[model samples]
Target: MKQLVKFTTGIILLLTASINGFSQDLHFSQFFNSPLTTNPANTGFIPDGNYRLGVNYRDQWSSIPVPYKTMSAFGDAQLFRDQLTYGWVGIGAVILRDVAGAGNLTSTKGYASIAYHQLMGNSSLLSLGFNAGSANKRVDVTKLVFGDQWNGKFFDAQVPTAEPMASSSANYFDLQVGMNYAYFPTDDIYINAGASVQHVNMPRETFYDGDNRVPRRYIGFLNASLKMSDKVILNPGAYYTRQAHTSQTMFGMNAAYNLSGDGNQQAYGGIYYRTNDAAMFMVGYQLSSVKLMFSYDATTSSLSAANSSRGAYEIGIIYTGLYKNRAFSDAIRSTFCPSF
Candidate 1:
């Protein structure tokens, strides 16, 4: 039974990689927390603070013999806030790592991003940004068993598998560009929309000797924040992305309730649905300058049968703060953005 499970898992991984021509890019169910990965234009688009830092972790397919794990860390800050008369520059960096399957196929990526945000009157803002990164993927070929290795009754490691074995690693450079627009009708209401394109350079990524290039991924998102009262705020958002022949769409709403009345403490809860995929439940809390969030994905697709609906779980931690010398009132007075 153990051998069968491992074999089945290996086959599934092989099929998925073959279909995509490479391993699928790592993503988090709490897409909103990983802003830099979602859109380069979000770099330093901080509304509530001058600078922000965050980290995220995800574990998937725990029911399988070998699970997939992913983690990321990122930080961004607004620059030239006092130097630029009409616009300010934002800079940020992010690092991501992922490992999958018994073969230990691992991927690591790092990116540096920058964006310029211009105030359009007192109610609107516009941003344009880009990022450059390096991606590397490696797998332990020795640990993987090919179909030809099967010896009828049981797989024999001693038997030679005549596969077109290439190098066990691949590396490439990646690029992305994005734009954002925001409108704040009043302090109580804010709306934002953005679109981005990943793999703008169509970098080649392959382990074999053939010429295969990563396809461009297009993403668009819209979100809004409405402050219903001093004690409550509502946030609703939608995200869509397409890469090659596959696409995904997700929509959800989360609300924050002020527990301290002074906005220093709050509680958050929400639900999100991924079309034909999974339903995500989220809960979070905020204290002063830090926020912690947790989410779980319950599989709704056919794959649920194998895993018994045990999908994935994720955790996110974010911190936002102003410079020690900077006055809170001054920061609020300089921008016309909504507070969440």
Candidate 2:
């Protein structure tokens, strides 16, 4: 049993390194909550409010000895709604941090984003946006145990692993751009779609000596909000992303039921599937301007055996508000979208 545990630990460490060093990017089961990380065009795409703020936290692989953790905070707001004749501007910023594995590899990123939204007609809207950011990754090499350190029966830390490690940290700049389109046929139905490209610069990102550039990541998503009745709303969404040779696809649906009748209080629940990876379940609540959500991912892949099907859990909180002194008479109001 001891040997089996060691083997599992080693495999998890390798997987962590591969995830951080290769094609896969950090992700969350609650993708919709992390709007800025999903696409830059979502920076200021609030449909029911003038400003928004959100935070997300995730812990993964807790069944293992070492767990991976990620966190993010973001805020965005719409501007010039009273001055612009046909369009408005949006500006926002996001900060993200992650720590992984026994080596305690840490990554931090920050971005500033802007977008422009134009009203095409009474029922349609168009948006375009871009973001620029910087990222830094560092790891503690001493805590890592190499294969060469094994001495038949056990591993020896005193043994020097003949590996040429050039540096302990790396930094790079990143850029992304995206566009969104929304159509509301009536006051009860809304449809939206968007696509974005990340790592537009393909900047170098490696601790070693060679030129290892980050691959361009392409993402696309579609979602709809349907009001079934005055007391219920249904939301269905699909997402797809590709980076280098790897890709991910997800499909999900969420339902909101009004508890206060006036839409000030609501209960939310949803289920999602990530291709062949995992199945996620979510529960949430909204009170006035604040919404809180919790989700859990259950492993469905081959790795489930090592972790007993326990994958990850996440928490998300969001707040939306309007300017107290601003007049809503001339503002473009989206009665079809969810208000929180």
Candidate 3:
């Protein structure tokens, strides 16, 4: 336990140190792992035969800088079943880009996973999942320029110039393990809790010096949904993430209300605040089988003074597919769908 604490502390320090130097690090969407882009455990959280498709876009500090933009699209569905317990498998990918005053970088990661769910009780399930993937990080050196005052100085060698600058890319494998516990006593109420660790082996980041490895990360989340009436449901969720010496926590609540007489459509609104990060507001809508979500963040930290009210924006979508009818759906349905 002491070793673990020490390790965790070291990682958090590194993360904070890095962030302080850059003024801002690559910002993950405020929703973070909820959309399944950051955690493997979420890959097959929805019922069998149900598919999840989502996209998130964020533009930060639009007022004080060129704006840091990040976007990700991911889709996952369960596949296969086991005799004693239900089993699921899924795959997804995400791409992120960052542009700052003197540097521009882009990264993409792809993942595939298999999960096993066991019935813990009459109304609860415990799932264990494993994910494997590769990430590519690249930087554009030519787009960088340094002051001429550094001419003939050692620092000049480290500085990049405008001649189509130099560029470097690195590919590294990533692994994540996660577990989730969910219980539903009634269709109208449910609770979910989960934890996941990313960058299992601490993949080396060749994009920087010393082949610095990306530090491992630990994330935990809890979400609950309560049906208030035939037309409305309230969902509250909390997320905590730690990397290097820094920790971030987000807490928020959202309400989804059914629209239309048939209940085939719905709309949701919510707000969230990340510790020392940003305050955000979001809305979403579901039309037939497609669900779309959007969010905007407001900077509240000291940096806000320089950046203004401009914050971040995110958009996501989810599509539900009928499993019993489609061939691929039928295959997975027969394997993972619970009989009970």
Candidate 4:
């Protein structure tokens, strides 16, 4: 476990050194479940509902001794439930944490989202949204020993390595903005498109100082849901992101089919491909108001050379509640609404 942590930590630092910026962020294969991270416009944007709460977790690089772990929990509430024509106001909050490597390099983030959704038509809605958050990163430098600390023929933990650092921890405020268009032409046909800019504040994040900070992340995504029949639904989506000189594009679809005659139970599966990254597979089952999903990714990029195609594993859980207004219909609904 110790060796694995050291190796991954070194890899991240080396990558950032090459880019000349303390860069790179965490993500998951199960993107759909991570509504806030994907787009702030999704805040409280639940169709046929007034509130929603969900959580997601990921464990990656288990092929190694020390694995990376991430988890998040979020909640959303939409107001103006009775007046469909006047539109609605949605608000949400999310908190997340990630830990990796032996240094226990940890990142903690909390964000609030606010959006104004204007009713465009009986079945369409347009939303403008914004998100504000604080991100804190911390590391125990003592856990790592640089080569400079090594003697001529051996390594000594007591030796002092001549390295300069401003601090072992950093905290920064981040801002993000987004817009989305959702069209529910019919109960069976639903589509949405959105764009967002994350880290708009560009707060400094380097432990060594200077202007190096969180770079603005630009993202664009589109998704559609088609109910092919009473028993089956097809969902397709594409996502694109750019930051600094690095960019990633992912595209895929999931097909869900009712397993029971009443359409209350479903079994679904899908595959997604991340350009130059890895291929991901997801499988899930929905029972009433609760849905649980699992996804895994295998490296398809050059990084596979060392890890032998090993990648990440993720899990997600979601629950949605129905609102009094029936202006928009959700293709599927979960019966479990927990009040905790």
**What does each candidate score in C-alpha RMSD?**
2.7, 2.2, 8.8, 4.8
Lowest summed lDDT window (length 10), candidate 3: 331-340
Off by over 4 Å in 2: 2-21, 328-331, 334-340
lDDT of candidate 2 over 254-275, digit per residue (tens): 9999999899999999999999
Query: Measured by C-alpha RMSD in angstroms, how accurate is candidate 1?
Result: 2.7
Q: How well does candidate 1 match the true structure in TM-score terms?
A: 0.93
lDDT of 1 at 9: 61
Candidate 4, superposed: residue stretches over 4 Å from native? 1-21, 152-155, 324-340
Best by TM-score: 2
lDDT of 4: 0.79
> What are the per-model numbers of colliding residue pairs?
0, 0, 10, 4
- Ten-residue region with minimum lDDT total, candidate 1: 326-335
Which model is ahead, 2 or 4, in terms of TM-score?
2
Q: Which scores better on lDDT, 1 or 3?
A: 1
lDDT of each: 0.86, 0.87, 0.65, 0.79
Q: How far is candidate 4 from the true structure (C-alpha RMSD, Å)?
A: 4.8
lDDT of 2 at 257: 91
Tens-place lDDT digits, model 4, residues 1-340: 8667656754764354335433667676777888888889988777545788899999876665446899999998887645544477889999999998757889999999998888664667788899998999998898877788788987677899877778899998989999999877666778889999998888899777566778898988988888888788898999998888788899999988888867668898999999987999999998876789998888887656545677888899988777663553342231111110
Instruction: Give the lDDT ranking, best first.
Output: 2, 1, 4, 3
Candidate 3 residue lDDT tens string, 1-340 = 8656544553454344346542222445455433464467777667524566666666765654245567666777756533244344544444444444335666676677766666554567788887888778777655544554267643464554544222378788988888888777666667888898888888887644555777778888888888787788788888888777677888999887888746578888999988786888988888887778888888776555444555767776667665665333332233222111
